[model samples]
Target chain A: MGKHVITMLPGEGTGPEICEAVRRIIDHTGVEIVWEYEEIGLDCLDKYGTLLPEKTIKSIAKNKLAIKGPTTTPIGTGHKSANVTLRKMFDLYANVRPAKLIPVLKRPWDKIDILTFRENTEDSYAAIEHMVSDEVAQCLKVITWPGSYRIADFAFKWAKANGRKKIQCVHKANIMKMTDGLFLEAFREAAKKYPEIEYGDIIVDNCSMQLVRNPGQFDCLVLPNLYGDILSDLCAGLVGGLGFAPGANIGDNCAIFEAVHGSAPKYAGMKKVNPSAVLLSGVMMLRWIGENAAADKIENGMNKVLAEGKTLTYDAGGTASTDEYADAIIKAMN
Target chain B: MLTKATTGRAKRPAKPITLVGVDVYIITENGIPAFDDYGAFKIEFVSNRGTKVWPGYVSEDLMLVNWYRCRFMATKAVTDADVDSFLTQLSKKWKWSAAQKLWNYGDEAGFSKAY
Candidate 1:
């Protein structure tokens, strides 16, 4: 079979390093992938004055799938979120992240596997901000019936397809009744349609507490956009932090798997940071295109390499550099 | 914030809880026709054990007797009782209310799924 072409938006900072390592690995494996490189992130910020440029979006639309590296989310003010903007513009209604227990990292739980189907676009992260007055600040938390219905339906469908037993509708509806209430109501309706799968709701606050207390109890988490962002990060810490957790922002027509970690500018050009997250994201990319075998090769090899614990990096408590770690896995695979 | 100085002030005192916005008929322990007040039942929780257990709001206290596990109390509370009766009553109020508030708040907290 001829190679399938994929685009690479290797953003600024360690983005380049990780993307470089991933690209090298793809080439080394003799996997049929043609990657097109493009400039984005801080470099885009300095030159184009936009965090996400029109050209980047256009290219991504053409490819329909991409492997992205960490980009600098312009700090301070007046900067658009490169990730959120793409999700909204493309209507990537679901953000799926599966945090598996990579045995290399020691955690309190035996099995910490969970799949989160977060509703993209339309939540606090909508980036719609307005000040009621000088003394007051307000942000819209919009949740339309259709938006909730689609996301909720999408989640249940995903859970049923994946053989997941239950779908947890995480919400703070008790507090943000009107907004989250609509989400919960949608979940109720969706649950009735999919009687095969179980449905449950948890107050957002207690859900967080319970996550730490017993991470295994939860299965599939479906929530509005904003809660997913905060909760997913915290869950990252539990399953080996950002260094290991991989994320994918998926829409109807396109999917972008990227390192959600920020560009550690200070660590730029050092080649010292862990590239596992981005690489694992590449694993996600592979599976996205039905390359389940390649995806398994990378994941199984990674799991074995980490568990061996010899060729380790700082994040996993050893001193191997990004290349060293990737090299170890590549060698181990051979 | 409550301080230790106020410790033991109410010591199981039967302070009446107001059933501010509810009223309903309840069949009493004697099988007599009686109205059980959900609000008053919840307010009297501290002293009278009038727990307003709605659906999914089960709990355990004294550790042995789980506080919120009353399926019979799954019905919404209405006016009547100690504010008049036993702590046990059937209710179908909001799934959360005070007892299950913990779980609802937890959901608001964030995406907890590990996978």
Candidate 2:
């Protein structure tokens, strides 16, 4: 059988170095995979005059499955989101992030396993926004019946497939009645299709408070665009910081698993950073490509590394360099 | 204790808050002058925008401006009688049917820097 190939779009700042480490670690593990590299992030923006460059988009379009490093997003400013652009472009409407408790990590919660299946493409993140007339700026929150229903369906399918008992739909329908009201209604319609899974809705703010108070009650929480972004990151903090968080942008046929964080410019080229986010994302990549053996191997190897607490990164509370960490994992795998 | 500006010195903002072409003014909450133009003061109040500080504007249209524009309206020094007359004009023009005397939708689209 032909080897499964995946493109790695290393973006600006520390994006390239981390990608290089990911390359080295995957190669050394003898993980059956092929690499296709592309230049993205700052360099791409400078050359192509936009963050979402044609080459990167073209690469993603061809490959159908890729794992990417971080790109910077200037919040609430000029232009829209980079991730939002990709999700909308490819119709990658379901963002799936599964956070499980890594052993020996000083986390607050127990049974800390949750999958956030966020509505990926629509709502405030669409960049369909304007600062119309200096005093009053506006962002049009567009919610369609089809978009909400499909994302809800994806969440329910994921829950049922994975044996998840509860599926929570988070929204701000009480305050934002019209837009979020539509999303809640669509969630209900999709729930009818998957009656076996238990379901309920929570207000967005209360949801945040609940995650902080008790994250165990959630199995898989799904939400619209902006709410999902904030909730996912908040949930990421619950398990570990965002370094432990990994996400996948999924459409019907296309899926891009990536390290969904900013380009940490200061840590560029140091080889002292943690690559687990991208590595786990690579694990997701392996799963997507039907290389489940390699995927399990990589995950088991990672869990083995985390269990001993040997060769941990600074963020993970140790002095081990990025190479040191990956080498430790590979050693455990061996 | 009242934190007054330095004696004999007018305090200013670090950055000048310029209201571009907006005919709005704020009168200090000190002893406001009488607004009843007919009952009246000897001289008319004036602003940097050259709009008359008329204590007599009863435009139902003007009262419907947004917080951004409404907060910046030109203020004439006004007294109790001026307030009463202004309130009466506002009630009549805006057609204040309710007891509290306010409009539900205060003409958001019609609000602008002009007037």
Candidate 3:
């Protein structure tokens, strides 16, 4: 097969370690992938004066496919999130996060498979905020026709393709009528076109309760930026947690696969944290590049390691270093 | 003044003039200023992002930012000297970032509706 080039963003902290584990695992698949490394986040601030540099963005723009480790953004400053910046820069409006049970792992709920399509660009996450007065502040919640409809369209199309039976649009339309109402309107319009899929609307608060109470009732959920950012994590809890959560921010031309979890800078250089999230993200990148066989091998191998319960990280209830766990998965590959 | 059009004809028009207004955006976090020093101009209204919030009715739900746009309408015919004096007075109390003059070009309003 021809060699594929992917932009690899090794973010700060344990980002590099997990990225290495993923690189080794991908290499074992024998699929030639050139990881064009790029630097970003807090570490690059002194050198580039910005968390996201032009060169790094150029690499992602050219390669069109990137897998990233979590990058940290300084808190309570004017600096925009590097993660949010990349998504908006690429117009990666559809943030697809799939939460499914890892057959071997023990959790409160079983057989939980939910796909969350979050509208990545608009909404209150746009960071348009100002202190009206010393006591009053405002952050504009923006929802547009094209932005809402496109994400809804993406979710519906993906649901139809993946044989998802039910799709729910979650929002607080009762309160923020115009903004959230437009989101629900877009979902309804998209749902109309896909008559085969059973689509409905739910208030975000109620949706959260239902998700925890009976997650199996839903198959797919499409939501605005803030709600999706929150509920996707809740759904992840239903299966395992951020450790098992694999996220993809996809636009028309470019896509970035990344773990939903933070960099966990405290765990840096320890080889202690679970590599499941990033490695599974790599599997997503593999499948996106049409390397289905390699993707299948990685997923199956990971499942086997989980089922065997011999080589697993501390989070997964076993004693294995990040590399050791990855090695086991690679060895288990058929 | 006459200018030649593409058809090689001199474009002519009737002299057009009307009363105009100006909006001075001041950063209010520093301080609010006295509105009495404007020469031949009166403060019509002040708004935050097009919502009326001063001199009359202010919404309780309206969140205030540090920036306020003060609309000044000319009481009489305005001159550059009048504008200079107003700005000079405003500069002493508040930091004004931008001032946009609302023009009446013939019969059309040259600025956006602040609704």
Candidate 4:
């Protein structure tokens, strides 16, 4: 097989550190890949006067496959989110985050496995906010049938493709009936096409409650943008925090696998932060590119290292440095 | 314990507000506001395309527009809770695009002349 050319976005702060660790681990997998490095987020903003540089966009556009680290999105209005900008640019409409309990990690829940499919575009993320008056500020919640249908279809097809048994459509249709009602309607229409998969609908609030109570019952969840954003983080907290979460933004042509955690600028140069999220994201990237064997190998190795409760970073309750932790996983692979 | 009597600012009695009416626009399938009567409140009038299209509306092809504005008046003085109940009931039958509360300031009309 020919070498796969993939775009590597080493983002700002601790992004570079984790990306380096993930790159080393991916290299150890012996997969033939040509890495095209690109800059994004805060560092890119400093250099190119744009958070998402044109060169980075072109690189991902040309390659169609990317593995990225966490990029900072300045709070309280400095610049728009680089992540959102990239998603819109690529039309990466499906945001997939899988939360599965690791055997070694001690948590309140066990045997928990859930996949969250979030609509990547449209909804409140459209950033449409204006003041009707000083007292009344309105933000339009836009949900089109086409947008809802495509995301619902993507969730169903993804479930069917991955051999998932059920899909639950989460929405607030009872309240914002027009916007969320249209979403639920689209989900129902899409569910009819896939008769094999068990389809159900739950209000967003109820879905959140149930997810915490008995998450084992849920197989796959499809939600509109806002609910997905909030629920995905909640789900992340179920198994483990964002440190162990890996995310993928997938469209028809382009896919960007990334760590769901923030850049953690405080731990940027210390090499103390955990790289599990980014490394697992790399594992996801490997699977996307048809290197399933390498993906499985790395996943198993990481699991073994975690299971042993040795050679872990400070966050994981061990004294090992980030590089030391990466080495341990690589050693397990051997 | 020191009470509010020691404070310099005097507390005024809370003003009572009541629901007079509501101007609701229900968005339909074709993105046009639907001209439908909400049973709980009296349907004062319905307008489309900046012209009255219901209850003494002129029959014209131009009046067949998607956007609709309906004025619903309460039978008596209703509290904010009553308005909430009205909205909950209205949402069941129609996809409300926009809603504005019609408050009566004694002799003042909260509604616009366009209605």
Summing lDDT over every window of 10 consecutive residues in candidate 3 chain A, give the lowest-scoring window.
A128-137
Give the TM-score of chain A in candidate 4.
0.98
Which residue runs does candidate 4 get wrong by more than 4 Å? B1-115
For residue B68, model 1's alpha carbon misses the true position, in angstroms, by 45
Task: For residues B1-115, write the lDDT of model 3, one tens digit per residue.
Answer: 5445545844445336454767787777643334774757788776554444565433232223466668888888876667778788878877889776655547754444332
CAPRI-style class, candidate 3: incorrect
RMSD of 1: 17.1
Give one digit per residue, the lDDT tens place, for model 4 in A1-334: 5799999998978988888888888889899889999989988766899898878888898898999988988895467788987776566778999999976678877678899999986787755443333234455566778778988999999889889999999999889999899999999999999999999999899989998999889989999899999999999899878889999998877899999999999888998889998898888788777899999989999999999988888877789888998999999999
The best candidate in terms of lDDT? 3
Model 1: DockQ vs. true structure: 0.01
lDDT of 1 by residue, A1-334 (tens): 4687788988888888888888776666567988878777667877888777767777777787888898877564556567665665556677888877888788889888788888876676644333322233455465667667877888888778769898889999888889899889988988899999988999989999998999988888888888888888878888989988788887667788887688788998988889988988898888778787877877777778987899987878999898898898888766
What is the C-alpha local distance difference test score of each model? 0.68, 0.67, 0.81, 0.80
- Whole-model alpha-carbon lDDT for candidate 3: 0.81
Q: What is the TM-score of chain B alone in each candidate?
A: 0.16, 0.21, 0.72, 0.68
DockQ winner between candidates 3 and 4? 4
Residues B14-114 of candidate 2 have per-residue lDDT tens digits of 33222111111333222222333223222233211111223432111112111111112224444445445554544442332211111112223212111
Question: What is the interface RMSD, in angstroms, for predicted model 1?
Answer: 21.5
Better of 1 and 3 by DockQ: 3
- Report how closely model 3 matches the true complex, as a DockQ value: 0.02
Candidate 3 displacement at residue A14 in angstroms: 0.2
What TM-score, to 2 decimals, does candidate 4 have? 0.75
Candidate 4 lDDT over B7-104, as tens digits, reads 77655433444457777776554533343555457777665433345664232332333545667888776666777888888788787778777764
TM-score of 1: 0.72
Instruction: Look at candidate 4 and give me any clashing residue pairs.
Output: B32-B66, B33-B66
